[model samples]
Target: MRQKLILERTNEIRCELNKVWDITKQYWYPLFECTREDLISFDSNYIMKSKK
Candidate 1:
């Protein structure tokens, strides 16, 4: 029963990850193309700030 519960949670996480991946692909591709460098810079800055 515990194993089954774990499997169900894993599946749910996988589904959510796929949804997020799809949305990121759909929306970010254009922004990525337009400001590839700026996006990279912003992401790096955001990650650094978040770590603090």
Candidate 2:
């Protein structure tokens, strides 16, 4: 009975992780296309703006 409960909980966690993965893949694929220099520049600008 305890093992069955653990298995169910594991399956729930797997389903949540899959959902997160799908969302990240949809949203983050474009970021992956960015050049390293572009990412660095963006990050620096973001940091500078956030400090204000």
Candidate 3:
């Protein structure tokens, strides 16, 4: 019975990790296009130009 409970908890943890992985993939791809330097600071000008 204890082993069954542990297995259920493990499954729950796996499901939660999968959800987080999906969210990370959704947002990470665009940032992957950026140079390492671009992420160093927030730039309002870059954002403004990007909107055009």
Candidate 4:
């Protein structure tokens, strides 16, 4: 019974992680097309703006 409960909890955690991964992929997939320089510029701009 203890092992069964542990397996059930592990599956629950896996499902939650899959959901997060799906959402993350949606936002990040587009950035895959960005050039390295574009990403660097974006990172620098974000840092500059956040310093305010």
Candidate 5:
């Protein structure tokens, strides 16, 4: 019963966080738009390396 309640609370927290992120994402900007693409590529490469 306690585990179920914990899971439910966790899900609620995650939903709230997603809502916050959705609002925050709209205001996020980069000095150069291209930098966002570079960061994304770098993140993907890092993720791939870590997966091995």
Candidate 6:
């Protein structure tokens, strides 16, 4: 995630990482308290893409 965002944002990776981190914490962090089923939410592929 950090790598992808850094690639996209270039020199702004630090700032972009912070923004994404905050947003992720705000919305998804609480899910950590949930059961594995709930936390799974779909799959890791949601955050990944096919590499060339």
lDDT of 4 at 46: 77
| Each prediction's whole-model lDDT (CA) | 0.57, 0.55, 0.58, 0.56, 0.54, 0.50
What lDDT, from 0 to 1, does candidate 6 have?
Answer: 0.50
> Mind giving the per-residue lDDT tens digits that candidate 2 earns over 1-52?
3444588898898779655544244344345443223324246677899999
Stretches > 4 Å off in candidate 4? 1-5, 23-52
Candidate 6 lDDT, tens digit per residue, 1-52?
Answer: 3445446477587568545544344344445443333345555575566442
Model 3 error, position 36 (Å): 18
Off by over 4 Å in 1: 1-5, 23-52
lDDT tens per residue, model 3, 1-52: 3455588898898679656544244344345443333344367898999999
**TM-score of every model versus the real structure:** 0.34, 0.33, 0.33, 0.34, 0.33, 0.23
Q: Can you write out model 1's per-residue Cα lDDT over 1-52, one digit (the tens) per residue?
A: 3455588898898779656544345445445444233324246677899999
Q: Cα lDDT for residue 16, model 3?
A: 92
- Candidate 5 regions off by >4 Å? 1-5, 23-52
Candidate 5, residues 1-52, lDDT tens digits: the string is 3455588898898779656544244343342233233234236677899999
Which 10-residue span in candidate 6 carries the lowest summed lDDT? Answer: 30-39
Per-residue lDDT, model 6, residue 4, is: 50
TM-score of 1: 0.34
TM-score, cand. 4: 0.34
Task: Write down the TM-score for model 3.
Answer: 0.33
Misplaced by over 4 Å in model 6 are 1-11, 23-52
* Candidate 3 Cα outliers beyond 4 Å, as residue runs: 1-5, 23-52
